[model samples]
Target: MSTVVIAPELQKFLEVVRAELSDLDAEEQREITDGLVADLTDLIDDQGIEALGDPVAYAAELRQAAGLVSARKQVRERVAVGIRVHAVLDAAKARCRHVLEGLPGDVDELLTSLQPAWWVVRAYIAVQSVLLSSGGWSLSPVPDDSISGALALLVVVAASVQLGRGRLWPLTRWSGSALLRVVVLAINLIAIGLVPAVAGGFENREWDNYDAGYSDGMNEATGAYAVDDAGGTLFASGLPVGNIYPYDAAGNPLVGIQLFDQHGNPIQVKGKNECVYEGPEEVLTDTSRVFFPWSDGAAQRWNVFPLPSRIQGADVAEPDPTAFTGTNRPAVSGFPFVAVPKVSLPGLLTSAATTPPKAFVPGARTEDVNLVESGC
Candidate 1:
């Protein structure tokens, strides 16, 4: 390559300008200096040495013309800002350390010693991320009793621990890279985001164990599970009661009786139009017979006592879902008991009628036999 020679004065001026601009990034410096040697040679050949002027002022003018910052001023401003930030961070860190150290029972040391605990936490969470990403909302973070789950947890936890200890692949080789730091931060955020779901999953984990119309401790009769189990159900003799019967002191069936637990939660049930029955000591067979559940003017309320029953007939306002497609079956629902005998009235409720409020006292069965034998 042939060298283009320049006058000593012009060469000296370019060198001085380059030196003044040393603090700018390489690309910015190259933008100002790329063709300068040849351009400066031509300029000096035309306008004698007087056009060169002071090199520092020339560098500043070139930077301004190119829309770049004045390098010396930028360096000074950055260094001053860095010093302030550094001092603030150091003071804050020291204050935190002092406050922690002053707390009861070596709090600072305890936190430092708990680094491995964080490793365990993040390890569980990292494994949790895979499950969450794969379409599980309510699930155990560390799934138990399964080889796939246990092995995944073991592998992730070991990797997470090694990463925290700076011994894993990316940690050992590329810890200083900004992209790697961002990836690590994103992984941490995802893990934190799944924390609530993991907790909720455990709280309602019985649903996960449900199978074939049976849940934990469920009997074949009255065996069913609901999400947020107790919230939407009533229990009698420790099993789920699908519906309740409420009879008045006169043995009259009551409908639309809003019931609640002691906690004041509205008792509700799932399933749109669940099959239910009535009549004491009757064979509880499901039929096309309908029950008109109460509506708070919005949706059907199944918890209302004595869900009124009738046969499918010509008067139902809505179509039957079980009917053939595009045709509404004639389904009718009505109050099953509009009237009954009164206990307080003369001859209305005889002693032969069922006892009022329908609860048997202790040994009432034996007493009933005794009364029948005595012919009272």
Candidate 2:
């Protein structure tokens, strides 16, 4: 005959009772819970889990039957919650176990083996709670940049593992004092409840960094990075280069530059680029500024670099459909940079004679090439 082991659910049920009776002496508590594991397993198998009912109520009845319920024990530090709340929880727990027990596999041992993993998770939740309270939590599971952070994390997790294994101080004995046990259980419950909120904080922080990492470099000290959402426009790094600016090797800002792709197709930017111009006002003493986009006349050439802007009171028409007659604000070219440091262009790559690149025919298919006649 196979030896019977106590189910994990039953063990959890007994743990709750043990916690409730934390005020009692170890010897008496042991007398109550000791050999009942096998007995209750048989009992539950015989009459279904309903036979055991609520573990809290059963503990109370057992204490009363054994004459262990003293007046002082009745009102003891059970301030955690009353019997009814515990009974409801016990019933819910039993229902969950019933559902799991019905599943067609060895779920009992599967859960039993996974208990250590929960220890690590609970420890992380505890550490995150502390960091969150300080209002500086980071997205990384281990957020410290130095060795101290790693050491602190190790200490916390090791303590938690020890606590879970019942190898720590008071629990190393039969149990700790009632007040200490109650406080520990309350802390664990708080950690469990904080999982969703902690996860949300990390997710929000991740997206914030992603969005800010790609915006205009004016707000950030760092240069702009290219983003994937530039809509077929010119991008430097990852940011959309709204208008192109070029510099000669001597660092002088060059104008009227045009760009093309590897296929010799003109590279055009699809989005609008608004340019601001400042000029002396005629009627007022203060200078004025105008917001208008300059273009290469009616042709609307976007591939041209350093597109110019018009001044406040120039002869150019107000930015509208008719404003594209000719490039306006010719004298006031509003290039973002006057000069930029030059960079060396890389040398052109040459293909190996043995492994030439594949020839690309614009619109020709394999069948079209096959049907073509060679030189006569």
User: How accurate locally, in lDDT, is each candidate?
Assistant: 0.60, 0.59
lDDT of 1 by residue, 222-276 (tens): 4444334444654444444434555466655553467776898666643123222
Model 1 scores worst on lDDT over the 10 consecutive residues at 366-375
Instruction: Indicate which candidate wins on lDDT.
Output: 1
Where is model 2 more than 4 Å wrong at Cα?
1-95, 171-185, 215-376
- Kindly list the per-residue Cα lDDT of model 2 for residues 1-376, writing each as its tens digit: 9976777788888888777677679898887778778778898899877787788887887677767864455465363444555565568768978888999997867887997887878887777667777876455656444667667777888888888777866567744444445556676788889998789768867876776655655334443444344455554544555555555665555555677889987666553423232222222212122323335656666566654433333232233444337564333244445456755567844322221112111121111011001110
Which residue runs does candidate 1 get wrong by more than 4 Å?
A: 1-8, 18-57, 63-92, 173-193, 206-376
Reference-based TM-score of each model: 0.42, 0.35
Clashes of each: 0, 6
Give the local distance difference test score of model 2: 0.59
What C-alpha lDDT, on a 0 to 100 scale, does residue 316 get in candidate 2? 28
| Angstrom error at residue 84, model 1 | 8.6
